[model samples]
Target: MAPEMISIHGGVFRMGSDRFYPEEGPVHEVAVEPFELDATPVTVAQFAAFVDATGYVTTAERP
Candidate 1:
């Protein structure tokens, strides 16, 4: 069986950080328009299928 897609509602989400990572400084606000996102996070099984078809190897596999 294949994974299902997910739908996300339109809303304003706070982005960035006030005091987290150096690059994350200067907090900012973002507007995420209504859109459908993947219901489940990509799993190893799905990645494996993609690799099997494309022979794709990740950086970790490069040593």
Candidate 2:
């Protein structure tokens, strides 16, 4: 079975931080559109199963 996804309503909000990193600063206003997101986070075992089925190799696996 596939995982469920939830719809997120879009809105305007202040983004970024001005105190932490110099590149992240200047908190600016941004608008976002509705989007769908996974209802739950992926589990390590699920990822392992995907890798096994697809023979996928992560960057960490490479030298």
Candidate 3:
């Protein structure tokens, strides 16, 4: 069975921080597009099954 998913609405929101590291400074507004997210994190066994069935290759498996 496929995993459950959550639909997110698109919107603008504040991102980052100005009080922390220099790179994290300059808080600004960010626009987000609608997207779907898995309801829960995938388990190792589930991921392994998916890879076996689809022959999916993870980045870590590549040099």
Candidate 4:
């Protein structure tokens, strides 16, 4: 069975930081829209199965 997904409501919030790193500096406001997210995390076995089924190779596997 598929994992349950929950709806997230859109809202405005402050993001980033100026006190931490230079790249993450300059805190700013961010607005996000409603979205659905899975309630459960995917297992390693599941990911392996997907890779096998799709014949996908990771970057590390590349020469």
Candidate 5:
């Protein structure tokens, strides 16, 4: 199926995991420019297609 284009407005957000990780701390706010995020997690079919197209091996395949 052909992909559809979507428009989204930009906004500021506090991004972090709320963990001891120093980078994640401070809970600082950020102004993120408009961009597209995947609407959902990758499906099995999508993963298969990626592996097939690139013959891309994942770390799991390594001992």
Candidate 6:
């Protein structure tokens, strides 16, 4: 099955929480350009299948 995908429009959105962990503190607005993302998490098996079928190498695998 194909993975579901979503399109994100360019905009600024508040991220992180000031009341949470220290690392997550200082809540701020982040600007992002348009992008695409998978609507749901991809499984390892599914990822492997796609890579194998496409003979694709991930950036991490590069020497």
TM-score of every prediction relative to native: 0.52, 0.58, 0.66, 0.64, 0.44, 0.54
Give the Cα RMSD of candidate 1: 4.4
**lDDT (10s digit) by residue, model 3, range 1-63:** 777999999999999898878898689999999999999998899889889999999899888
Clashes of each: 0, 0, 0, 0, 0, 0
| All candidates in order of TM-score, best leading | 3, 4, 2, 6, 1, 5
lDDT (tens digit, per residue) of candidate 4 on 1-63: 877998999999999998879999679999999999888888999889989899999999989
Q: Counting only residues 3 or more apart in sequence or on different chains, how many pairs clash (N, Cα, C under 3 Å) in candidate 5? A: 0
Model 4 spans with C-alpha error above 4 angstroms: 44-63
The numbered model that scores best in lDDT is 2
Question: Model 1 — TM-score against the truth?
Answer: 0.52
**Count of clashes in candidate 6:** 0
lDDT of 5: 0.79
TM-score winner among the candidates? 3
- What are the Cα lDDT values of the candidates? 0.84, 0.95, 0.92, 0.90, 0.79, 0.90
Report the C-alpha lDDT of model 1 over 1-44, residue by residue, as the tens digit: 76677878899978889777889877788998888767779888
Q: What's the true lDDT of residue 37 in model 4?
A: 86
Decoy 2 TM-score against native: 0.58
Output the worst ten-in-a-row residue range by lDDT, candidate 4. Answer: 17-26
Residue pairs in clash, model 3: none
Colliding residue pairs in candidate 1: none
lDDT of 3 at 24: 85
Which wins on TM-score, candidate 1 or candidate 2?
Answer: 2
